[model samples]
Target: MEAVDVIEVSREAIWVALKVGGPALVIALVIGLVISLFQALTQMQEMTLSFVPKILALFLALMGLAPFMLTVLSEFTVTLMDRIVALG
Candidate 1:
């Protein structure tokens, strides 16, 4: 409830967000870079060429990593709930 508590909570929330999302973000970044390179090499600038693969890869990655992501988010939620109870 104090400024320090708020800052701590905010920092934790950001960390949890990153933990949950970082994998997908990394996958997307790598996929995008690879696709860009391929496009550059092949001289194929089709819009779908870049977007479709990234979307599919991201979806597959999210599916594959769902359990880990769920565990992290659940742990963070439990931590937040504990803090809320303590505050109350």
Candidate 2:
């Protein structure tokens, strides 16, 4: 494949990765921020406090978003396969 083809595939892979990961990451970030605010307000500085909610939130988000994530990844995979076929 040409350099342009490789670059296109790489760019697509990165975009797909970001699309798939972005929601969970965003969820986690928001949860963590809220939790931090809670902790600050309550003056309850517990390490586990930060982790438990973030984990649970991320888990729930992943569960909710799994189908969308799967579809995105699969579509990217199909695109890659089509490119491979075209190349060969």
Candidate 3:
């Protein structure tokens, strides 16, 4: 493949990764922030307090978003394969 084709594929790959990961990441961020606030308010500074909520939130987020994520990943994979075939 040409350099531009490589770059295009790489960019698409990155975008697909970001799309797939974005929901869980965003959910974790929000959960972490809320947990931080709660810990601050309660003056309970336990480092381990962060993981459980974030993990649970991420799991739920992933479950909720799985279908959409799958669609995005599948579309990207198909598009990339098609591009590769066309280039070949």
Task: Give per-residue lDDT, candidate 1, residue 38.
Answer: 98
Which is superior by lDDT, 1 or 3?
A: 1
**TM-score of structure candidate 3:** 0.91
Q: Write down the worst ten-residue block by lDDT for model 2.
A: 79-88
Residue ranges of candidate 3 with Cα displaced over 4 Å: none
Ten contiguous residues with the weakest lDDT in model 3: 79-88
lDDT string for model 2 (1-88, tens) is 9999999999999999999999999999999999999999999999999999899999999999999999999999999999999977
Estimate the TM-score for candidate 2: 0.97
Ranking by lDDT: 2, 1, 3
TM-score between model 1 and native: 0.95
Q: What TM-score, computed on C-alpha atoms, does each candidate reach?
A: 0.95, 0.97, 0.91
Candidate 1: residue 62 lDDT (0-100) = 94
On residues 31-50, what C-alpha lDDT tens digit does candidate 3 reach at each position? 99999999999999998898
